[model samples]
Target: MKRTVLLLVLLMAAGTASAQVPSPSQPPTPPPMPTPRGEVLYSCPGGIDFASTFSNDGELATLRMPGQPDIELSRAPSGSGFAYSDSYYELRGRGREATLTAAGRSMRCHAAGRPGEPPRTYAGGTLTVTLFPDGTFRLRDRREGAAEPVLDVGQWAQEVEGGVRMVLRGIDNSRRAFRELSVDKLVADDGTELRRTEKTDPIDGKFRLAGMYRDAQDGGLFTACLVGRTYGVAPGGAEPELEKAWVEATPSREASLYVEIIGGFDNNNSITVDRFLTLKRDGACPALVFRGSALRDTEWRLVELDGTRPTFTEWRRRPLMRLDDAGRFTASTGCNTLAGDFVLDPDGLRFVPGPMTLMACPPTEAEIEKSFVEALTAVRTAQISGTTLDLIDATGKRRMRLEARGR
Candidate 1:
């Protein structure tokens, strides 16, 4: 009886479990898949193409293309595609085309070809073009079959006067030719005639110079001069001659005076006055200043006892270096560079020589350097009264005085 009861209980439990379980063939149906969003297709005629899909949150989830490997650009919210082509291309909801042209080449973009659908074409030729979003565009051409250069229209010369007395010369490959084309005659505000003698030649035809003229009514006289085969126009017959004279007569002012030391000093280091020299304006022949140097107690004095003569051995012929209103001075001191500044004072003039790099020179050159430094250093004040410059030291001693040549 106990065994029978246990078997009965087990059978009842198995029957209840089997009744509650559902069959595998009758499972529940799944939810429908979400529709794709965002840009489905973007492409250009020159093989650039792209496609994209978005997630439920409107975020880009996938991007696909042909030829190029697929890329997952969804790190951030992504919904755009990029492609590279010879020319620019873009596609939105509807199909559109953009074309560009330059030189002898043309590029076109069109709707991508599909089964049973004709592909749209955007063709560009020698003309250059720019397309905008509002369906408007700009076109330009240089040569007849090429795109025009991106030059400012203001830079182009245009015909002003009616076809009268104007000449047109065309240039092609650096060769000049005459043409019967319209020429722009530029004129100044004062009614002065301005001529543009340069032009480019037409591609398909031989060029010729065009000449046009108008009646003169109080017009400026125009004279033409022919030298060999070249002709030039001037305002008057004597204009060219006057221009030449003015160019030749322009005065060139000298900036500084160059003084060179010549002759040898005596064994006692006494330099005689007769050996000194001065450079003239001719810049070729040096004038010998007979009394050039005088011997003072220990140092050779640049001035003689008579005080009117400068003593030196010899000086190279050079033009006097000129100075402007400013007191800054620059000059070549025979064998080396010399520069300094000068200040005018009531008593005398002061000269401050900038430091100079020393170089090896002959014995006479060394003496000249020493003397030049001493003369410059001893100046307490300097005055450019008239054409003469008088330098006086602090001890009331007259160091040197220079007179302007030809003054």
Candidate 2:
């Protein structure tokens, strides 16, 4: 009887404890992050934005900005967010969307998709070489209807004589058959030979080959359809120098880009191969500009200060100004460089000028630099109309004018 009574008491206690104990509280659900598929528009902190297409497989991506080349991205390190790459350019993810950071801007975007074929998706697994008679070559992944070459020689090695040598180490997925290429002889089928001169030997001298679109300068910008060349001049010869040639470029600067091919003698392999030369000439416009919006990441050149434009004499390059979406603004006076911060709001724009870099330049360039900084301090408002960007002061007068390049 006592044992029965004790068992009943224990059962009653157990029921009482159960009644007092609290059930586990469920955790709150996070807001749903956007699906990483389809067309997504990303905005940078500077109010500048761009659009791109993300593949449904959730890895491949394609940038779809007009006037810009489509950048293809493969998968990156995993997260609830995803990242994709090609090194200098990349895409990352955060809270509700991912970010594509290109040319130094981190733009956040919301992604969505459809059941259609991915615009950036391409058939991989083939390799091809694009060689010109001038001996300049490009390495590309053979794809169906690829608008751009996968790999150009400039992306890897220094343009040298006999061409540059590169090795593919451990990447198995790379375009196969990329190895040392042995060129027996350079033929004239592709214009490998430059005009022979009495004083210059094709292999050891300099030539001024003209190109299209002479470099230009607006305010502080060096604008040009400038082409960069590298020649493997006799490896150990005194460094090469630039000299005037029978080439001149203006209006359609095509004549400015003259291909000067030379034959390189390799002491290591006892092989003679052809190489090319690069040119540096004084022109106008520099291609590097601030991109995006005016109050955003757009670069500005001071084409005119107040009511007039300054004329440059020695170096036709103009003072350049590039402002990124990050509110960071940089200015060059054709000599020294200056930078500062800018703020944008519904009330308009304002500049919080910063320090200038200290460097000695020619008297003319120094004077131009001083003028550029002085003009920047007067900026209070700004606007973008078509391809023209203008800066106005607090008194509502135009302070500077710039033409947007490569927009």
Candidate 3:
């Protein structure tokens, strides 16, 4: 009886101790961060926002807008900044600013960064301004689509009441002071507004194309390294300099030298040389051989026939070819199909024609098909440059050109 009574007292004491101890409380949730105003990667004047992400190679950008489905766009040739577009919508961005156009309506946007940050670069109307952390500044004035700057100078700068002041020292040692509206801007004393811009890579702009320059009877030929296009150097201010450099580098009648130049496109098949850079005797395009083995299993579209571009009325009427792992191939001859067996050994290639369908074709298409088959039969080696394929004959002449489809 005494033992039972002691156990009952111990249970009652345990219950009292448990009741006196409080339960552990949960941690308080953190408050959500407030989104800053005017921080729109894709925004409108009324405060609408949108988002976008780019592909790894920067070839595509997908956009997401409020109350709308996602849209994907392919990168297109642009004169400045980055441009992506489709049949319906177009988007262009430079530095931290962007503009989107849809259905003839345009909207401006700002990336997610506060303006007026120090140590920044800004550009507008061919003027580029850069601020340094050591209280120094530089300005460059160059024309659009040109690399060589017309006016370049290092100057002194300091933070002022509203923004920053830049002092320029002329050739006569006379000092001139100017004020910028903001750190993110590059403005002149005359109130020319400059927008923020990022520094570009050496090969990123329209100028600064490095390639191989070969002298030809009709002016010259320039095969760009990264661009992978052979262009006829149009007569311009830099033509005389280019010829001089070529003659100096190689006096031989048949000369092929590497060169760099600042220029823009004259047409689809030629480039106007604005400035000539340098010519190297030992330089070659390294981008050609890097992806040579990538030919197999890829859909190839015929781009050139016997060193000339082939024209087709419709895209579906163009020639197409594909090589398989089993050493066999199939191709489209614009109107019929052709099957064959192929042998690929390192950089060499041989096509053994198997069978082909004889279908009635238009006169122009028939002539193109005849040349195309002849060129393929003459191919003894292949050279690849990114998405381009050049089929060369035993004599080292490029007879046929193909490109990876859908590129």
Off by over 4 Å in 1: 1-314, 317-323, 345-348, 383-387
Tens-place lDDT digits, model 1, residues 233-259: 123333334333323432332111121
Residue 245, candidate 1: how far off, in angstroms?
Answer: 38
What digit string (tens of lDDT, one per residue) describes model 2 on residues 95-173?
2234555445444332221112221111223433333221122334545688643442311111111221221211122
- Candidates in order have lDDT scores of 0.29, 0.40, 0.57
Q: Name the regions of candidate 2 deviating beyond 4 angstroms.
A: 1-294, 314-316
Candidate 2: lDDT of 241?
A: 22
RMSD to native for every prediction? 45.4, 29.2, 32.6
TM-scores of the models, in the given order? 0.23, 0.30, 0.32
- Candidate 1 has a TM-score of 0.23
Off by over 4 Å in 3: 1-293
lDDT of 1: 0.29
